[model samples]
Target: MAETVGDYVLQRLREWGVQQVFAYPGDGINGIVTAFGRAGDDPHFIQARHEEMSAFQAVGYAKFSGRVGVCMATSGPGAIHLLNGLYDAKLDHVPVVAIVGQTERSAMGGAYQQEVDLQALFKDVAGDYLVEVNVPEQLPNAIDRAFRTAMSRRAPTAVIIPSDVQEEAYTPPAHAFKQVPSSPPGLTRPAAVPSAPDLRRAAEVINAGSRVAILVGQGARAAAAEVQQVAEATGAGVAKALLGKDVLSDDLPYVTGVIGLLGTRPSYELMRDCDTLLIVGSNFPYSQFLPEFGKARAVQIDLDGSMIGMRYPTEVNLVGDAAATLRALLPLLTGTPAKAWREKIEAGVAGWWRTMEQQSMVNADPVNPMRVVWELSERIPHDAIVTADSGSAANWYARLLRVRGEIRGSLSGTLASMGPAVPYAIGAKFAHPDRPAVAITGDGAMQMNGMAELLTIARYAHRWADPRCVVCVLHNNDLNQVTWELRAMGGAPKFEESQQLPDVSYADIARAMGLDAITVRSPDELGPAWDRALGAGRPTVIDVYCDPEVPPIPPHVTLEQASSRLRAVLKGDPGGLHLVVQGAKTKLREVLPGQDR
Candidate 1:
């Protein structure tokens, strides 16, 4: 049989090394789904419970695998459902390609059933690359460009394929739609390298500074060693943005932990005190946490020229790939080792972790959330692909989990959304089936997406060669992060009735889905339960009941924020006073010393 337009699309995906696609089917996309069904084992179509999950799974796949993530949806609502997850990809700068099934071309303008203006709807989210296949012959090139644009830009791309066009027989093009470039369609061009003059300028700025600091972001993830070398040569201390948490080890003497609200005190101190700041690949948004404008001479290195100095004033903008730029700039500079700065960062980080350890070890009436994260972090395999949902769970994992060598993971950092943990784990497992994958999620986020997606894991759990997937649900029975935020903002606990979840057995739900599952109510049970989950060598869910009152406190607290907490407590909010007393008694002891009652 001659190939169909749908067949060409699937073939292009396979040619580009996309082995799996997360999808949810509807009438509008029946043709493409049928084509995917026929394509067989190469590009296995994973049927997710919702289109949102399909998109999130794709995001997770791309993050862990370093390849373009692909997801598909039917027209109208199905396509609309993909926006949230696609936005997650866009904001996080992950490469994801979304294929939306449009109505038949003849029916599009008539406002027919399930006819959504896919282009119009996706403009803001997938505007970087959004195209609807107008002709059957355009499918191949469109597919190729969509993938290439997504990969090169590290953003979400959408292709709207009409069902009628998908069903049409594919024919060789009469002539090219546009001139074919010399390089292959899906291959990305090399990142720009900095000019000698730019490199020399950046080098001069750094060499002239007495105290230097480097702030790394997701852009510098591949340039960890280069960042370390630059920091070492310049006598600089390193502070990573939250997205770049795994780029370097927290144990590095010159490395401070994350910067910003979820950051460490040492990191904040570094940014405040540095005389010169070298920003590589991180357009970190929190300018308030950055060095004061006039206090520091700044230089930035980025592959994207537009983002080079968008976040801060730059004295020297070195527009190039982070590692390459640093390598080139290294030889031009007269480097001096700032032993004083490095030692200061090391001591601060040490003291901070010591305080964190004390807080994490406190025994609450229910299991402390920090303890759960700490135990899981300690037990997971070094190579495990860990994912955190955006909530208190992300905060705990950020503060407590020490990602050493080869422990790669991701969070919904930029979108700051919840419910991605489950799909992320499933996708990570598919990408690296031989390795273990873990998802640390909260009760609210777990119910939102993970609860349904757990069944998706069950359906394909055996397909993976050596599946060892773990979903650890921190069942605090409340939207703890939001509740804390309300208290932090001087508002009473108004969301408790709305945000507090019913005490349902997540472990029971997992068992019903035919997976090994357990619920832990005490700290002692935490370790054994984790051991069982990891050792099961199959998909497992461990529901650990955590203390909902514990706060995900930031490294620094302003007087206004402290006053808000006090106001909330004075207003008779249930957990506010308890949280304050707990902080005073346990968390503040190491830091406040004599002030702790």
Candidate 2:
């Protein structure tokens, strides 16, 4: 039975549960595209503009959906274009499987059109590359291996499906590889405990502590309930790094707060006041900001023994998982809790938490970006997936958002990047078009990549599905934040870049591209504009002209950079005179502020 190699590739992906492949069709890959269109059974190919955007969009889908995100490109240049996104996904630890069309197998050494060593080109970017000449029989094995490697290592895998092989076939033998769902861990722990006396010694130390604090990390997320139980037994206050936010309910009274650079200073101060700081599950990077050994005794716990003392110096190091360690230590704990020490620590935490929260509030009426995003967050539908592009907008999102229910944070689980949010929103829409997906992009970041992807929504709506996507642009007229940053860095004023951006208009550009565009310059117009845009329900762009400086540098950042940047903006080249006008304009604006436009 002769079958097209393209058909075999489709069946292999179907077996592996790949429902969508984000792509930009090219003549070199027409056979596969046609085969994909006919596969039916609810599988669909999403067409993207540049193959680069397609790759990035696929990476996002892979990361959030925990599925093998598939992308495809034609041979040579098309395949070359996917490298950036492939590398991005690789570095970000995402599972992406890229399928690049290749020159006919027989044309390899003849310098064929659009032919090159595609495998060598993508070697570094992909964790694994499979150049399969035959489909049907060989393709399934390669697809299985690609998914296994990608799922385990979270790196991209690229498959080279040469053109001529598309028409070849091999009937499947009676036996086929069956797919299975990943199951949760059950019953007993993997590692055993130490001597009973050692466990007793650890528990004794923990029980005698007058004030106890548990610092939660990713490991804690794995056994959050167990960690919570330990905290409940000791009545210790809990603090966590960014990754552990949703591990324990944020609204829990016993949960002190987040502890890190972007977190409240009170948490750090509270840790200093405590007699014991138990580092659980995470080796958070900022040890200097943590309470010093002189201020409090530090104890570290981890599933991997070596991770202890790798970051901060620890007085006690436990070589078991956070949950196991806590369970073992419970029995050894002795002595009644000290009333005075606990009360003083609790008082400090209470006072500090209150003051820190007060600092988060903003009342500026071309409302400060902090207040704006906060209010905007309140308005978003619960379960909405929000992606934030970098720069001032991202900074604000990190500070202002409150995850009350289920949500995907812009920079939560991975190293944050710019230009991802816009394209990511497109992928999110494709993943769950029924739900609201909003991309909050800064003017600078949007201009960096937004021009290339605005029509993805249109393509899906007019070309694939009816559009229900939202693209929100935080349209600050200039790179005001960058200008301020350069002044702080002792570099030449970046105003040269800022002054040049004033003429750019996203609303005009979105309208030009056939998207519903609305520019909201004032707080009063924001709500109504958003409502109208949401109601219109196509690919809509709401350009909110926000004040760039409204994102006040958090306390963690030193003002030294801000001060130096101000001087650089003033004296760097002939911008001295311009800074004077800008500074004065800034002051006048304070007295009688105009629209950010």
TM-score: which candidate is best?
Answer: 1
Candidate 1's C-alpha runs over 4 A off are 176-185, 592-597
Model 2 residue pairs with clashes: 5-166, 486-565, 487-564, 487-565, 487-566, 488-561, 488-564, 488-565
Cα RMSDs of all predictions? 2.0, 6.3
Model 1 per-residue lDDT tens digits across residues 297-407: 999988888777887888999878888778788787687787887788788888877777677777675888888877876777778888999889988878888778688
Residue 456 error, candidate 1, Å: 1.0
List lDDT for all candidates, in order.
0.85, 0.66
Q: Which stretches of candidate 2 lie over 4 Å from their true place?
A: 109-113, 128-136, 171-250, 253-367, 412-415, 461-468, 479-484, 498-502, 511-515, 527-539, 569-597
What's each prediction's clash count?
1, 8
Candidate 1 RMSD computed on C-alpha atoms after optimal superposition onto the true structure: 2.0
Superposition TM-score, candidate 1 onto the true structure? 0.96
lDDT score of model 1? 0.85
lDDT (Cα, 0-100) at 122 in candidate 2:
78
